[model samples]
Target: MRWAPPGFGGKRRSPEEIKREGWREQKVLVVSETDPRLTWPERELVRQLGDKLYGYRKEARHGRLDP
Candidate 1:
């Protein structure tokens, strides 16, 4: 589909119609480590990635539960 040029074209129901110039989305992945569907390796990788990006969790840092 040809994207329309960026401008006011009245309110659109689906924003996907307009061409979003220079717009990049910052995305987050949400998952539960204990989710039954995920395997051990997948859960471990997710845990490692979280720690690498955000540092040690508050629970581990303070020796107490965060929530």
Candidate 2:
């Protein structure tokens, strides 16, 4: 979206146009604990999936929850 000016009006820009503004190059996107893309259950599902594919975290080792 652009600013609404006297002559020019705000219009929705295409994804490509928006990308060109700052995402012209490849970027590294970090997904942290505070990531908003998923709900709590969804994140838990991903954690479970990873445990199945890889292994449990150190805190979850040997059926214990010690940190």
User: Against the true structure, whose TM-score is highest?
Assistant: 1
So what's the TM-score on candidate 1? Answer: 0.44
Flag clash pairs in model 2: none
TM-score of each: 0.44, 0.39
Model 1 C-alpha lDDT per residue in residues 1-67, reported as the tens digit of each score:
6666776465665543222321434343566667788999999988777777777776656774433
Give per-residue CA lDDT, model 2, range 1-67, as digits (tens). Answer: 5566664765678755655554545562223333577899877877776667667877668765633
Off by over 4 Å in 1: 1-27, 61-67
**Candidate 2 residue spans exceeding 4 A from truth:** 1-34, 62-67
Local lDDT at 17 for model 2:
64
Predicted structure 2: lDDT = 0.61
